[model samples]
Target: MDTLHIVCPACQTTNRVRNDQLGAHPDCGRCKQPLFQGRPVVLDEAAFERQRTRSELPLLVDFWAPWCGPCRMMAPAYEQAAALLEPHMRVAKLDTEQAQALAGRLNIRSIPTLALFVGGREVARQPGALTRADDIVRWARSQLATA
Candidate 1:
């Protein structure tokens, strides 16, 4: 069986999880928290800083706002993309409205934007909401290949 390396969201401890168990409730080896939670784990400044530096897998961050229609539409696609790319990439969502400071610091100019970060460096960004899951997944896969 194939396995994937994951950095625990709670403890930041690295865990090796079986690929087949990804869809199931895989627990962190250190903290015993569920690993494949559907929602994007919200990160604060320190957690974001730590994740950007320590995550071995690629990261796909969705910058969105709650009231934006397009952002709402894109939420499901983001979730689907996350499920598809698990064990290979880490998917996170940042509420630009809530995380305005970070958004401004990152120079985010749009409501629904997708950013791909690898090894703590942002490699690519796309503005506007994605209409399809394939588009999001394709972009992330390209980033993974090029990174």
Candidate 2:
């Protein structure tokens, strides 16, 4: 059976999930939290690194700041996109205010940036607030297809 490496959103421990069991509401072996909760997982720098580098799933990271108006406006749309994208890809959010160093390392020049990472490398990035859920989903799917 093929297994996918998934990093626990709550515990940061990597869990090996069988492909056939992905839709069965898999739980983390360490923290026992549901793996795919149909919401974007919030990540700190270290946990972000683990999910991005260690997990086999494609990762879509939204780098945003609380004070940014565009970022705030895009929040709900991003969440909606998460619901549409999960099981195939993992969606996560990284606050620029909390992870300033990480934001700097990624050279994030805008208030809201959407980056697609596959196999630990950033494949594409969109530096703006995508307000529509369909737009976000389409853009992500296109990026992944090209990646």
Candidate 3:
């Protein structure tokens, strides 16, 4: 059985899960919560670092602001993508307004930017919030190819 280590955004706990169980709704070992719920998991700096460094799967990070209309619109698409990609990829969201330091460090000047990370390093970034879910999925798949 294939296993992947996923960092919990809520509790910062590392959970090992079967790769095949990702899309089937795997829960955290510590928190007992669904690993890939439709909502974006909030991550702080330390949690982000842990997830980026330890995860065996590719990560899709959505950098967004709560007040932005496009960001709000993209939320559902992101959630859908998460639900679809679960065990294959690690999906997360960061609120730009709250994660100011992270945003500054990443040089994100846009409201809704998406970054694909693999092995703790960024591979690709999507600027603007007008992108469709299919396009985002395709881009992520391409990044996975490079990793």
Candidate 4:
């Protein structure tokens, strides 16, 4: 059977799940937390690295800072995009303030940047706050198609 590697949001454990079991709401082997929660997972640098490198699923990371107005404004739309995109793709958020070094390494020069990673490499990046859920979904799908 084909399998997909999914990183647990709660514990950052990489779980090997059969592709057929994705819709069954697979739980983490290490933490037993549901894998797809219909919301963006908050990731620190370590967890972020693990998920970005190990998971077979495409990872959509929202680079945001707590104090940025546009970032705060886009949070709800990002959450909605998570609801629509999960189980096929993984959506995560990294607080730029908390992951300062990681942000610098990624060369993030703006708030509310959206970067899509597939197979451990960044395939596309958009620097700005996206306020509409449909727009976010559309952009992600388009990028994945081209990727």
Best by lDDT: 4
**Model 4 misplaced stretches (Cα beyond 4 Å):** none
Better model by lDDT, 1 or 4?
4
Candidate 2 lDDT over 3-121, as tens digits, reads 99999889888999999998888999998999898989999999899999999999999999889999999999999999999888999999999999999999999979999999999
Q: Distance from true position, residue 22, model 1, in Å?
A: 7.7
Ranking of all predicted structures according to lDDT, beginning with the best and ending with the worst: 4, 2, 1, 3
What tens-digit string does per-residue lDDT give for candidate 3 at 40-127? 5677677778888987778789999889999999888887777666667778888888879989999999978989898889998888
Assess each prediction's global lDDT (C-alpha) against the native. Answer: 0.81, 0.94, 0.80, 0.95
- List, residue by residue over 25-73, the lDDT tens digit for candidate 4: 8999998999999999999999999999989999999999999999999
Q: Write the per-residue lDDT of candidate 1 for residues 44-140, one digit (tens) a residue.
A: 6666766777766677888888899999999888888887787567788888777789999999999799998888899999999997888899988
Candidate 4: Cα lDDT at 122: 96
**Models sorted by TM-score, best on top:** 4, 2, 3, 1
Worst 10 residues of 1 by lDDT: 38-47
Supply candidate 3's per-residue lDDT for 114: 88
Candidate 3: pairs in clash: none
- TM agreement with the true structure for every prediction: 0.82, 0.97, 0.85, 0.97
Show the lowest summed lDDT stretch of 10 residues, model 2.
Answer: 30-39
- List, in order, the clash count of every candidate structure: 0, 0, 0, 0
